[model samples]
Target: MATGFYTHPDCLLHDTGDGHPERAARLQAIEDQLIGSRIDIALQRETAPLASETALLRAHSAAHVAAMRACVPATGQAEIDADTFVGPHSWNAALRAAGAALAATDAVIDGHLDNAFCCVRPPGHHALREQAMGFCLFNNVAVAALHALEARHLARVAVIDFDVHHGNGTEAILAGDPRVLMCGFFQHPFYPFSGVPPLAPNMLNVPLAARSDGAAMREAVTREWLPRLRAFAPQMIFISAGFDAHRDDDLGNLGLVEADFAWLTRCIREVAAHSAQGRIVSCLEGGYALSALGRSVVAHVRELADL
Candidate 1:
């Protein structure tokens, strides 16, 4: 089976206004790099559908869903928080961003694809059950994980996050669930300031100090994430693929590079092959520095496609 690349044009309509790091240009950069690297022709590309209220309800409160709808502006941007904004098109974009993950999950679970990548936005992993913050409107990976467990009837699933920032919302939603295993490494003492001491036994959050190098990340993955992931033996895997930790990105002080992202993808792929029958779904979470984000995504997608 081929690797599926999912995205939608509506994702570009989510206007964060000027000077915001989480802009539509982020997705453009990745697409430009993919085309430049000629990786575009190697994978299957699909348009993301809009997520239903039923699907959104699985990971978010009905009030949250209603609030997102109520928050959508008919003309200009509406502020959900200091960092998060919703434009006229943001409602559709947010739904599609989340829907891409759901569609990819279905594709992978149905054996139509070996694995998939959802390159949509506004990025998730920061949005909570009732609150939107950190430029996220909904927890995309959490929504997908719950979909896998409930709709697809998967017994076990693992969510892996490597963003420079802790996936606090993901942890909040999935922490105590025994059917799910969530592992991540983030820059601690940083934004959101959670995950130092994990919320639950099912969560394995490794907090790295600012300026920590790729070596430290690798050690944490090998010593912490890998062992727990192997023991859990998940039936499916989901990745909160974030590249903000890249040394060039200013969003965080970590020193990861393209090679580090590739290595992490390889590790996850190996684990997926061993236990999940090679089913993996990765959704874009965070990555600033345009050049680094594009290059890092190319590296990650290349690994996902094994190209």
Candidate 2:
């Protein structure tokens, strides 16, 4: 079966203003690279829909949803925090970004697709249950994990995040859930820092020092993430895939390269094949440097699509 590719044009409409790294051009770069590499040809393309309130409620408080909707300006943009902003179209764009995650989960879990990738912006893993921050409005992966458990009746699930920064919000939302096992590495002593203490017994957050390279990442996966993930024996796997850790990206000091992303994806695939029946759902998170982001995503999708 083809790998499902979920995206929506509306994602570009949620502008972050000039000089912001999380701009619309990020998604364009990924698409352009996929097209240039002909990876798009093998994908099962699907337009992302608007996520329902019921779905959002699974990961966010109703008050949080109402507050975010109120923050959307009728025109121009509204800043939700130092790093997050909402333009007139942001509400719809956020819904579609999150909806794409849910749709990817359904496609993979229902056996309609082998696995899926959600190319979304306003990158999640930062937004909490009650607030938006760090360039995120909704926890897309968190929403999908909840949907997989409640809607699909899956008893166990796992979330692996590999952004340059810790998934503070994802942990804030999913830390204590007995059905979820969250694991990954991030550059510590960085922005929104809060994963050092292993938020909950279920969270396995490894901190990478500044300038740490692919070797460090690989070691963490082998020594920390994989052992816990294997013991958990999740029925499905979700990835908060972030490429900002790339050495080419100026946003962070991590030294990861395209090959590193491929290696990690392959590792995740192996875990899925062992316990999840090859089920995996990956969603785009943070990657600033355009060229690096594009190439890294190509490598990741190549592994995911097994092309």
Candidate 3:
């Protein structure tokens, strides 16, 4: 089996704005890097389907999904927040984003792939169950976790979020769902401040100090996240892999580099190998520096694909 690469052309069509950080070029950068690497392992490229109503319901309310669909303007962009925007293509792109996650989960769990990477826009992490913010329309990782529990009949799943900002949306969606354990490490005192308050016993949210760099991140994983994750002994793993913490990325104060992203992937792989048969699916969340973003994603996916 190979690592599935899940994406769609419509994902690029979800345009933010000319100067927005969540631009289409971010996906282009990742695609270019992957193409340039020539990492020789079977690559399963697939078009992402729209997530089913049932899948959406796993993580979000039907009313929330309906309202998001309704907010899709006929021709122009709708500003959902100071940092969030939805153009005409936004609705379908978000669907594909969440859909790609579900597709990846199914691939790994069904023995169709070793693991998967979802490269889509409107990066999810800040999206709550009902509110869209922080350039996120849907909580992709949470949706994937829910799919694993409900559709795949998995008893327990886990979500590992290594983004610079906390995955407040994922927490909102999956909190108190005993079927899932979520371990998140994010730079503290950042935008959309949350993730420190544990919503459930299954949730392990580790907040690192700003400008802490990779050593601090590694420590958080070793001391905080890894123990909780291993204790939960999840049936599958999902990652909200965000690169905005990269030293070159200006969105956050953290000074992590590509090595940090690769290191985190290695750690996640270790636990997945031990407990979940390496069933891991990663989705793009936030990365502002296009060049660093490209390099970091390549490192992360290279590890996921074991290239």
> What TM value does model 2 have?
0.99
Per-residue lDDT of candidate 1, residues 175-275 (tens digit)? 89999999999998999999989999999999999999999999989999998899999999999999999999998999999999999999999999999
Local distance difference test, candidate 2: 0.93
Candidate achieving higher lDDT, 1 or 2: 1
The reply for model 1, stretches above 4 Å from the true place, is: none
Model 3 lDDT per residue over 46-102, tens place: 788898878888778888889889988887678888999889999999999999999
Winner by lDDT between candidate 3 and candidate 2 = 2
Predicted candidate 2 versus true structure: per-residue lDDT over 1-307, tens digit per residue: 8899999999999988888899999999999999999989999999999999999999999999999899999988798888788899999999999999999898888899999999988788999999899999999999999999999999999999999999999999998899999997889889877898987999999999999999988988998888888889899999999999999999999999999999999999989999999999999999999999999999999999999
Candidate 2: pairs in clash: none
Off by over 4 Å in 3: 40-42
lDDT, candidates in the order shown: 0.95, 0.93, 0.87
What lDDT score is found at residue 303 in candidate 2?
98
